[model samples]
Structures are given as C-alpha cells and as structure tokens.
Target: MNSHKNASLTPRGREHLVKNIASQGARKAADAAGISTRTAARWKRRYQLEGVAGLRDRSSRPHRSPTRIGSDKTERIEGLRRNQRLGYAQIAERVGVSKSTVGRVCVKAGLAKLPPVQDSVPVRRYEKERPGELLHMDMKKLGCFDQPGHRVTGDRTRNTPRAGWQALHVAIDDHSRVGFSQVLRDETSHSACDFLIAALRYYRKLGVPIQAVMTDNGSAYKSRRFAKLLRRLGIKHKRTRPYTPRTNGKAERFIQTLLREWAYAYRYPSSDVRAAELQPWMQHYNFSRPHSAVSHKPPAFRLGFDGNNVLRNYT
Candidate 1:
C-alpha cells in the first residue's frame, strides 16, 4: 500500500499509535493520532493478536474473487488470440465474456498485438568500398505554401490554390552517406541537370571524385540532357529496375530523413523561410550528426578529414 503525503498512519506511525494506545485509552490515542476511534481500535486489536506483522501493510486484493475469469477461460482467450488472431470483441462474443475481460487476458498472455509477418526473401544489403564510388540521386515533391498550412494552423479554410509545387533534388554518397540537396522550381530535365552539376561541384570541392550515379527511371533522369551531362563529365549513370525504387534505396531513405527532419519538421510561415533553413541543416547533418552506417561517426569522417581540417573548413 502506498502511503499518501497526508496519510495519518504509515507502518511506523501505526506502531507508534499502537504503543500510545497501550499507554492511553483507544479514544485518546485516536485523538492524538488524528484518526477515527474505530480505526485506532481496529489497529489495537490487530497489534494485540498478531504483533508488529499486523501493523505492516497488507495486500488490498480480496482473499477470493468469484467474479474473476477462470484459468480455463483465460487460456481459451489467449489461444483464440494467438491461433485465430481474433480481436477482443470477437473473442468476448465467442467466450461469453466482456470485451474488457478478453483484453485483460490477452495483455497478461502477451498477445495484445499480432507479430508482423516475416518476409520470404532475405534483404540484399551492399555498401561501396570508397567515397564517390557511387552516388544515389532522387527527387521528392513538396507543396508550396504562403502561410502555415492546415497541419500547423488547424484551419483548413485558408487554402492556397496556386501555391505551386517544388522539387527537392537530393544526392547522397553511398560510402560516406554525405548528402547534398536543393529545392528547385520544378522537376524538369533542365533543373535535374543543373542540380546534378551543383552537387558534383560540391563533392569536387570536398575532394570526392564521382565515379557513377544511380537514380530511378523518372522522366527527368531519363532525359537526353541528363545522360549527355553524365557522359560529358565521364561519370557513369545507373538507373533502377522498372518499378523497383529500392534499387536506389540510399537516395530514397535520404529523402525520407529530409522530410521528417527538415521539410515538415517545422511549421514555417512560408516556403522561402523553410528553404532558407535547409543549408544550415545540411551543414549540421554532414559535419555534426552521426551516421549509423559509418559506425556512428559523422559523414565527413568517412571522407578521411582530420579533426582540425573538418572544424576549419566545414564548421
């Protein structure tokens, strides 16, 4: 039994009250202890019969409960949950018990939720041996907003019909997990080519020479301009299999993180305000945040940058 802050009697206080009862009368002891006379008398009788053990707290559970479900019913509920995957209401209807009872039984048996089915095919995971061996590129589309959307303001009445759409082009190094991203006006072939050039330039400044690039078979990526740009730079281009986005999983995962940690992560007054925060966020991601794939070290560490050089250049 947990004693409340204003509880008149704890186990120790009960013992003290019992001693006071022995010296004074029950009424006087109850008055001194600030408890009812009947309560004091009951404790005095328990102390007389069972000593200090009686003064200690006891379980509040009743000695027997006729209304509780039996072990057989509990077993039936759990078996239904595990074997038939029946919900609480279904099990209750079958077992002639309340839904809450079935729920309780399921919780106690650790069958509250069904386990996720395992995939038949084992995941084929791979990594590059060196920085710039392969770069993953992808684009994520985001809606433009003039003010906080319904998600932030909770007012669906204010809608911007011609708010337009922006494409977020992202490129991440397969080996280092170093990411470069930009929000552009559209997802056209020209914009894709320009973003790729900017990304390649950024990697070149970091001394990571690009060898190949991987992207999904989107219209912009399949454009002649994008292919010619790669050929001119002497960088090979690899496209994911038809309808297989996971083949270019690194860029896909990077876009997911970008959305969760940056794009919708905050409620900005306008798209421009959100765009302005991306550069600083990217700097933090590249230099400060630890990458689990690279042994919990920052992405810059994989590029072989010493502590001083990283702080001096990237910081």
Candidate 2:
C-alpha cells in the first residue's frame, strides 16, 4: 500500500469510482469522486486490462539497487558487532566500510541498539482444526457520541454532551476467525445471553454448530443464567485464567481489528449512524476482507463458503 501522504484513493473507494464511471462519463465520474481525470482514465484502463487487482497500490520500492552493501560485508559487520560489542565506528573501521553504511546495515538487521540479547523462546499458539470447536467471546465499550467527536473536527474545545457508552459484544470462531458482533446498551448478563443466542443462530445459519465457548471471567460470563443457557444448549463453557487474557486471545484480537478498521475507519456524526453501518461492515469483513492469519483469504472461505454461497461437501 502507498504511504498516507501519497495515497489518492482506497481500494474500496476506487472501486466505487470505477463503478460510477460505468454509467457516467470519465470526466463526470472523476468530478463526482473528487479524483483527477488522468487518474480516472489510467485506473479505468487498468480495470479493463487487469480488473480490480490492477487498481491496488503497488510497491514503490525499486526492484534492484547498486548502492546496497553486499551480503558478505553485512555478515562481517554483524559478526564484529555481536562478538566484540563494538560501536558503528569501530565496526566500520574493522570492516573497511563507512560508518553510515554500517549504521544502515545495523538498523536493517535490528542491531542498532546495545541492549542484551532477548530470550529466543517462541510463543506457542494453537488453533482448532474445525470451525465451531471453540468460540471466543468478549465485549468492548465504545464512547457514545451526541454529535461528531473531536476526531472528526479539528477543534477540541467543543463541549460534546455525554450520552453513555455502547458495549460491542463479539463472538469469533477460533479456527476460521469468523466473527459476529452487535452493539448493545450494556454488558449485563441478560444482554450477554441474548447476544450469545443471536450469535449461535447466525453461525448455525452458516452451517456450523458451536460446541464450546471461551470467555474471560467477567461477571456476565460467570452468571448463573449464562451457565444455564450453555447447559441447555449442550455447549461447554470455559473461562480463562485470572488476569491471563491470552487464553481468549482470538476475541481480544478481533476487538482490536474491529476498532481499527470499522469503528474508526470513518468519522460519524453520531453513534447511531456508526451502529447502523456495523452490519454491512461485518458482512464485508466476513466475505471480502483478507485475513493475514488465514493465508490472506477471507473468513468465509474457511467457513466452508465462497462468499455467501455455501460449497457443499466442504469439511
């Protein structure tokens, strides 16, 4: 992706522009989309030749460079720094190179600091083999809005009245990373139970029967009513160890992604308008957005579907 300074359009926003140009003329579409006519024509030609993928931002880095230090010299520099604990000047002196070259190489190799070696132990992460084997649940409290917040407007002096908070309850499948989210007034036990029921129904409609759920030891998840609901549905309920959220990491990570991509993706005049956009954003997340953890495929692909259509006999 292009840096923010150089980027002219987002992928989705570019798609919207090209779609409009299909019906309207290029100049008019460019005017409507607030983009240059040259850009519109170029992207239109790319769209015709390479489709949507062509409109995506390509890497700006050159394919090759003559000034970069050779691998053997970089290795010698690293060896001197690691064994002798020498500064860039000393290392460069020994390696017959300039200090700036040594510094750049050290920065690229993550040896620019004099800190001690960190423990090399790798963190163990596990995922379920099948969808619905384990579901992670969590709630995120978002600030409510009476009007556009300071993030939308440059002035922070305006007194925005408090209207309360919106609790976003989310459930995600541990295996596929598919998520279900809803905005609620509170995170009480009753609300949690209702959200669970609705989430289970939504997953069931997608052909996955949930077997177990994992949550933090929150008051709502620990309530008798929630336990009773789980028992009635024959779904095992598990809680993470106190103060160790990694056990429920899936839901935690989903909440982070939700906040970055959807909740703050665009400015809204009110929370109600933001809430209204959640369902469509959720649909796009499930069916279109590529996930890094799942080999860059959308969550729906792992959930035994191609987009919204079910692919039968998929395990």
Candidate 3:
C-alpha cells in the first residue's frame, strides 16, 4: 500500500510544482509566475506518466557561452609580444592586463623567449674622422721562451722561468689604420717617448700633422718624461679613462690582430728569435694583409703609404 501511495512534495520541488499547477494552461500566467509553459506541460505530462522525478532541472546550463576570450585575444597577445618584446609583467603594465592574463594569452599564442648574443670585442670604436689626426698607442707583452734549452712554440710554456719581451709600442692612425710598431725590452716612459718620436717621424714622412696621441693610463704613459716628450714634440697627449681599454679602440684592435696572426702563429726557442720573428710578420701585415674595415684594402693602400719596397699585395 505504501509503494502504491503517491508522496507529497519537497518544500523546493513542491514550490515548483505548485507554481506550475497554479498557472495551469495559461502561458502568460506561467511566465509571470516564473514557470515556462513547456515546463508546466512537462510536469503534467510526467504526472500523467512517471511522477515528481522529471520536475528536476536536466542539466543546469544551456549548451554555450559566447563570453570566453576567443582567437582574437590570442592574436592580440602575439601581436603585442612581437611588436614590443615585453615580458609578462611589462606587457601587463603596458597593455592594461593582468600578468596571468598575459601569460595565458602568450601560451595560447605559442610565444618563446629569445636568448642574448655574446659580446667579446677587445676594442670599442670611438668616432674619428681623419687619418693621422688621432693616433692610438699601446704595448703588448708576449712571452719569449728564451729560457736556456727550453723549446717554445707560441703560447706553449714550460713551468720554468720565462724571458719575455714587449712588443714595443704600437701606434695606429684612427682613420687610415696605418700602424707603427717595434719590439722593445720593456714598457717604460723612455720606451714610449721613443715610440712617440718614431711615430712623429713617420707622420712627418707622410707630411701630415698629427693632432693628438691617445693611449692607456699606464704608469709608463702617465709619467712626466712622457709628458715632456709630448711637449717637446709639440704633439698633444691624451690618456684613456681609468681602466677603460675600449677608449683606445684602434690600438686594442691592432693588438688583437697581432695576437691572432703573428704572436701565436709560430714558436720561438728564445726571446731574440721571437723578436726577430715579429719584423717579418709586421712587414706582411702592413704590406700584404687586406684590412676588412677599409674596403678590404691593405692599410698601406688606404693610408696612401706607397711602399715601393713592399713585397706582396694581400688582396
């Protein structure tokens, strides 16, 4: 008998059923009472057939929501990153979006972070217009493996003592790229003054008045003797900023060139042999080597140094 008996309604379910019952078949009344005619019909149909079970919502939501961020938002995120290359925080700040939004958008856009490049240049170029106007000078000390009975072949060293020599002082014309160098026993003011005198002589040979000479802030260069030498020659002397090698770009670059091509090119058993080796290499570099910066022409050609005695054309 209990199974056969139909039960009364739940407070909520009963409210729903009672509303449908009150509306009956009137569409306007059903709508005004927060019940759809279809729902009322469904309840009646179910009462005639199954019962209260069909009164419940089938699945709460309709099929679709048009409010989601679409393909357009993804494209926008990619466009922002491509144009500005901003990170999530920066992109959020600039575009007036949340960092999480930016991140999600970027993820949808298939964006990736770019790695940085290497910067290993020994020389940093400063602007200089004319040849012989600003000359840069520096000294490079290469090991001279002239230690008795020790075989030395370019940077290969024994744990024994070393007899090294200074690649005297080299001076390069900022515009012409013309260079002057001599192998010296040490880096001293006297050595620098000697190099300066030779440089002046070389420029004088070219009939060009050198405006100034720039060099590193080495003690040998900053000494009073070097100052007096410059005063005597009536040539201006300029020192680079403290600890700044790039301030004298040409000199530093030439030093790099010398190391790559000549200093490490071969091995010498003694200091004298190393120094002797340098002259031929310098001759080749000055006369035969085609400089890349100056239209791939040799410095001698670019600077108007007509060496009738030059042995080769490094075209």
Candidate 4:
C-alpha cells in the first residue's frame, strides 16, 4: 500500500526486478525496470536479506533525532501547566524550552488550558431547589462618562469628560438564574430598598415569589431601613460573611457577566444611552442568552417557563 512519487519500482516491481536479475543479470533487469544498475543490485540485496519486507518501502524518518526535545523536558513542561497553571511563556521559561514547544507539550499531555483562577477555597457549589427559594442581591458601581469610554470607543482619548458614578443594583434568582437590574443614583439604603421592591415586582410578574434574600455586608444593606423593609415583607434577609463575597457568588458573577456583555458590549453616546439599553439587555439575558452553568439553556427555560412570553412582551 506504500507509494513513492519518484520511485520507478514498487514492491511488486522490485520483486520482478530481482527475479529478472536472477535470470537475465543486473544489466537487463535495470534496463527493463528503467532503474540504474546500482538500484537493481540494491533491490536484489534487500530481497535476499528481508524478502518482500525490505522492498515494501522503508520509513524515511531517521531512527534517532538529535535536535528533538527530550521526554523529560516535555514532562516538566506539562507538570508546570497542570500543577501551577502556568501560561505557555511561563512554562517555557521554567522548563527551558521554546514557548511553542511548551504549548505543544501541554497539548499532547492533555493539559493545554485551565479554568479561570478562583478567589477562594474549593467550596461546593449549590443552587436553591426552587426558583423562589432564594435571591441574590448586590450593587455594582460603574464610572459614568459624558460619552463612550475607552472600553467602548477603543481610543482612550476619544471619550468626553467624566460625568460621575452610577450604581447598578442587581438581583438574581439562585435556581432559575433569572435576573433584574437597574441603574440607580446611589448606593444608599433607600436606593437599595427601592431596587429590591422593583425586583420583587418583576419576579412576581413572572410567578416566582421571593422567600429569602442574600446580600453582602455593605453599609447600605445593613441599615435599619433595609432590615425593616425585609422584615415587613416577611422575607429572610441573610448577609454574606464579612470579607467573603463568594457567599453571594451568584450576584457577583452576574454583575461580572453584565459588565462584559451589556455595559461594555456597545459604544454609547452618553451614560443615559447606556442606561436605557439595560432593560433590553436584561430581557435578552433572561430569555435568549444561554447560561453555561445551567446546561446552556436560558433562565426562563430552567424555570419551566416559555422564553417567548418575555419576547412577546418585548415585541
């Protein structure tokens, strides 16, 4: 089955050549095969030593490679990648190999890429069993600009003067991953309470009643007004551990996703323009965008609700 581009004699042809040489001599066999006398002799010698095996096209690769990186070095490179989660350049520097070689080694070792680094210990991930069981509440602060900032416009100098700061109040259901957000004036207790009320109404419209709420130990959330509002609503209010934001990881991660997909997703003429887009973005996020943690289905789908309902209202 082996093929050669320039070879005049295949394995069968070489066998014929050897037989011809045995009967008619090397000169006639070489002439018949259209090969040199030296080639005919070489084929005859190969047939004598290896029978048909040697004539069946041997491998052209050298048995040994002097310049190839050693297995020990490749192991070291992969070790750095798997154990330390080093990038290609870092692994290469540590293992004394080229960055490309380190990348290849990592790929071959099945350790080429890793997940993003975590800020805390490997705590178990848990989701509320029911959509209305718990809700995560948090506030994200974004810098207000007169015009699109560097992240949107690409050129840092193209932006107008800084307008001020904007507080983004975000609420997400733990089980369904449904979210609601608003651009607020400040992070005061009154603003937080107002956002919470609006968020509750939004979820209520979707038929998911709120039973419990979790927030970071921010001063605003700890205020008596905020506590009173929660108490009156008969909703259990839990604060995350001091200095441990991951206890409210759902809202934290949601805000990060919002910043990536909405806040910086487009170039806005002004802060007002960006703020206006939040409602539409939230609709898409809840009804259309796939949530990776939830089996790549939208939030509404996870809650056994038709996303088209939200889309219908949007239209």
Residue pairs with backbone atoms closer than 3 Å in model 4 (clashes): none
Q: What local lDDT does model 4 show for residue 20? A: 92
Question: What is the number of backbone collisions in each predicted candidate, taken in the order shown?
Answer: 0, 0, 1, 0
Q: Model 1: how far is 263 from its true place, Å?
A: 6.5
Once superposed on the true structure, which residue ranges of model 4 sit more than 4 Å away at CA?
1-13, 23-36, 57-123, 222-225, 239-247, 290-297, 302-304, 307-315
Q: For residues 1-315, could you state the per-residue lDDT of candidate 3 as single tens digits?
A: 122144333335544664656656447545645667675565666655655555443555768876545666657677878776778888777666688888877776667663344556555456577777788899987555544333332344553464444555688888878777878767888888887887788766655579898988898889999999788878788888898777887789898887777666565455677567776787677666788877787677755655564433322
Better candidate number, 2 or 4, judged by TM-score: 4
> Against the correct fold, how does model 3 do in TM-score?
0.56
By TM-score, the better pick of 1 and 2 is 1
Quantify all predictions' global Cα lDDT against the true fold.
Answer: 0.90, 0.88, 0.70, 0.88
Q: Over the full model, what C-alpha lDDT does candidate 2 score relative to the true structure?
A: 0.88
Candidate 1 achieves a global lDDT of 0.90
My TM-score estimates for the predictions, one after another, are 0.70, 0.61, 0.56, 0.70
**Residue 313 in model 3: shift from native, Å?**
11
The true-structure Cα RMSD of candidate 4 reads 5.9
lDDT of model 1 at residue 231?
95
